[model samples]
Target: MADTDLLKTPLHDLHAELGAKMVPFAGYEMPVQYPMGVKAEHLHTRAKAGLFDVSHMGQVELPDPNAARDLEQLVPGDLQSLEVGQMRYTMFTNENGGILDDLMVFRLERGLMVVVNAACKNLDIKHMSESLTGPVISHDDRALLALQGPSAEFALSALAPEVATLQFLTGKWIDVDGAKCLVTRSGYTGEDGYEISAPADQAEALARKLLAQDDVEAIGLGARDSLRLEAGLCLYGHDIDETTTPVEAALTWSIGKRRREEGGFPGADVIQKQIAEGTSRRRVGILPEGRAPAREGTEIQAPDGTTIGAITSGGFGPSLEAPVAMGYVASEHAAAGSAVNVVVRGKALPARTAKMPFVPNGYKR
Candidate 1:
């Protein structure tokens, strides 16, 4: 709420020293952009590498051997199938089958390492504690740093040579800048990268080391938004929320075949029904005809003036050099190339539904 009450990430001073313009986000004072500007920072990541301070996100540990089985009660992912060191993306759902929060679950040797959104982490923890068995541990002393782009491997390998062995959606314990850290060869920026969870005390030092490497720029929230938007990734509380089902979000793929058939998770019945019968609306990408970006909440309409949907996330894609967006529209209009119009400032802008990841994903399989 108040600026004085905002939480500071471990890299706060580093961000300030790098000339970042700070703002309040999810109860934290974070860098919105640095001196290089959002556009330059964005292109830098696409061309080289960008370092992001995502410590605001929550990290939780489920230490029980039955964590996977316990997890199936909350989300639809096939967690029991995950091998050691592998990671999967899924979401927490409400009883109505609407998405509560999206998260990444890493099956480590001892337990499960889960990373959730900053805005929803608290509720996710409470929900998990109430539903799962004992001992849900929160990592308040950890900081997460995302090194993303083509050079991510090259830069990160200098510190943790073993990191190069990790494929996409995999993680392992490693020493980064001499700090015992959990390094994952995974990212959501549609680029090759790693997410490092390091001790808070050692975070700044590790971040500085990564920054010292060639081709790594300190990125802030401004570019982060554009990068994820271009990548067609959903932002919680915007593109998805308590009212949107996984099927409606086009995220049915995250549901494992067994889970889909068994129908054991919260709202699984509703999700199964949606899987058999199509949902009323589905998420899809939209490309505006011109440079004027269709921002979130902009109403989407059919060519004949019938309202079809609204833009949940929209912005100028530095990599695509065009305005890219994703939103939900009636299932009939969700098909790529379907004609649509985005109402921005009471004027209709010609647009069309397009495929996601407006920028091609570069993840290493």
Candidate 2:
């Protein structure tokens, strides 16, 4: 796509001023990395705090008293019972149990807020508009920013002290730089962080203020991808897709027990059966021997050369200082510590099915 055709975020100029390397991602010209480089930026985020311009992601609000109950028909989570200010991680499933996209559902005081992937936001909006019985209001006027890492609360607390009291997966409206913003104590980097949604016009100012903190540095998409990968969080269109079921992706934990017992959501029968009888294939963490990072599409095989499955997301885990990957494999070979081989460059490299979160999750629960 031409550079002119790429959309720019509210903080585009700021990213450019920081010498960020811009790249096209999900229909937007986003900063893939800054002058600090992916390795340094990633390490800095793990130790301190990293500010990211995630305005490309879509935010939508459902304004109806029955919003949660109406939205529950499309997802497996028990959204109807979600307390105000609570957030839940869920997937939109198709009739065949395949995931349309994974999203964060937040129950707000007046309604519900949903954060969807940049690529699938439109489709998700259309689906919700047609299926749900509420007014689906898209937040095109808002900019999303993520402040992540160990010192996230410290940096953000200076701006809004009430934010420091928020636990993981909870959010509330707060005053930041005199701007009324909705701040959530959740993020994709497996760290204790906040995803703040501010008015588009004031986003740049908020970002500038956050970046001014001693512990906060601007990070880009390159480190964002690597960080989420190390955290075992699935990237839409790569780790989880319309062809992949949540069960096959090993995300059954997000399904409520009541939903599991009483089928109501789309593909509930299929998902329940998979839960009862077990899925044929399972997503598992893969740790390759040595340093050759196995990338996406790498084929997985048994010791006997039997093709088991394939890798979906793989990369060098900066935190682990090793090559980490996740892929679907036959359930027989999906057990943690099970030995397998990954075919990279026509050679079968030894690997093992290790547990997920290559690095331990640092969420402040």
Candidate 3:
């Protein structure tokens, strides 16, 4: 696509100012890396704090007294009992048990706020509109930013001291330099962090202020991808898609226990059956031996060269100083420590099934 055809986030100018290498991603001209490079940015984020421009993500507000009840019909999470200011990770499932998309649903004071992936926002909006009764208010005027790492709390507290009290998966509206912003103590990096949504007009200014903090530095998409990969978080298009079911993706935990028994959401029948009978395949982390990184599309093999699965997301773990990957494999091979092989560069490299989150999660909760 032409550069002119790409959409620009509110932080486009700021990214360029920081010497970021712009790339096209999810139909947006996004920053893939900065002058400091991916490794530096990744380590910096782990050691201190990093500011990420996640404004391309989609946000929607659904208002109602029974918003959770109404939204429960489309997703498997237990939204009905969700307390105000709480957030939950969930997926929009299709009738066949396939996942349409994964999202964060937050129970705000006035309604439910959902944040979806940038690529699927348009279709997600349409899907919600067709399935729900209440209005689905898309927040095109809002830009989202993420301040992630161990120093996140310390950095954000300087601007909004009230944010220091928020625990993981909790959100609240707070004032940042007089700008009303909704801040959530959650992020994709598996680090203790916050995702902030502010008016688009003020987003750049707010980001600049955050970047000015001693603990914060501008991070780009390259580091963000490696961070999430090391954390064992799924990337929408790569790790999951319309054909992957929550059961197969090792995400059944996202479904509430009551929802499992009651079986009301879409694909509940298949999901429940899998829960009872077990799935044929399951998502698991792969730790390849040696330094050679097994990348996405690499075929996973058994000891006998039997084809088992393919790598969905794979890369060098900056934090672990090793290669980490996640993919679907037969249920028998899903156990941690099970031996496996990865076909990389025409050679079967030794590997093993390992538990996820190559590095431990640092959520405040």
Candidate 4:
């Protein structure tokens, strides 16, 4: 894409003024890190607080009373059961049970709010519009920011005291320094944090206000990726894709029981069958034996040197101070603690199957 066509978030200039290293990601010129680098940013966030600009994600609203029913036809989550001001992580599946994209749905008054990956937002919106009969509106005027870490609640509480009361997976409208915004008690870093959605025009002001807090520091895409990886969260195009089913991705929990029994969502038959019969391959966490990080596309091999699967997402965990990754392996070899090998630079790196969330999640609820 041309440079002019690259999308810029409301805080683009602010990132530049802060001496952040810029990189193209999801068609947006985003900050990869500041002068302190990814490791420092990562550690800072875990220790205190990190502010991240995630405005590249798509913000959309469904404004019909039947919106829940309309959305239920696309994703596997039980939207109707989601109480107002609550959020749920869900997936858009195809007819074959493979994921189109994993997204967050927030139950709001008079409508449902959705946040989707930027790369697949257009396609996702088009598909949803074609499949549902509701009035789907894309909120391009909004921007998203994530404030994460142990001190996140305390820092954000200074601006919106009510935000501190929200539990994990719950959200509500709040005023941040006089700017109206939506705050969700959820994050990708396995930390007790909030994701704020506000008008694009007010995003920069909100970010600055949050950073003014003693505990909050500006983070970038580099640390954000590492944090999510350490948390064992799936990235859209990597850990999950059109070819990966929810069952195979180890995200079957996202499928509501009612949806599974009702068989109304797309690919319900195939997904329900996988739930019953099991999938041939399953996504599992892996921990390599040394400091050497495993990168994507690394071959995961059985002890016998037989290729079993490939690494989807991998990186050095700043918190664990070790190399960690998540990938699909044959069902027979998917158990935690199972011995495996990751081919790194043509050399077999000793690795072992590990349980997810390499670091424990610190959500309040």
Top lDDT model: 2
Per-residue lDDT tens digits for candidate 3, residues 208-288, read 989999889999999999999998899998889988999899998899999999989998899999999998899999999
- Candidate 1 differs from the real structure by a C-alpha RMSD in angstroms, to one decimal, of 0.8
Give the local distance difference test score of model 3: 0.94
Stretches of candidate 1 off by over 4 Å are none
User: Model 4: per-residue lDDT, tens digit, 219-310?
Assistant: 99999999999999999999999899999999998888888788888798999999999999999999999889889999999999999999
Query: What are the per-residue Cα lDDT tens digits for candidate 1 across 1-365?
Result: 88889999999999989999999998899999999999999999999999999999999999998898888899999999999999999999989999999999999886799999999989999999999985799999999999999999999999889999999999899987699999998876889999999999999999999999979999999999999999889999999999999999999999989998998999998999999999999999999998999999999999999999999999899998999899999998999999999998899989999998899988999
Clashes of 4: 0
Better of 1 and 4 by lDDT: 1
TM-score of each: 0.99, 0.99, 0.99, 0.98
**Cα deviation of 177, candidate 3, in Å:** 1.4
TM-score of 4: 0.98
Whole-model lDDT for model 1 versus the true structure?
A: 0.94
For candidate 2, the per-residue lDDT at 164 reads 89
lDDT of 4 at 31: 97
lDDT of 2 by residue, 143-259 (tens): 999999999999999989999899999999999988999999999998889999999999999999999999999999999999999999999999899898889999999999989
C-alpha displacement of 100 in model 1, angstroms?
0.6
lDDT over C-alpha atoms for residue 45 of model 3: 96
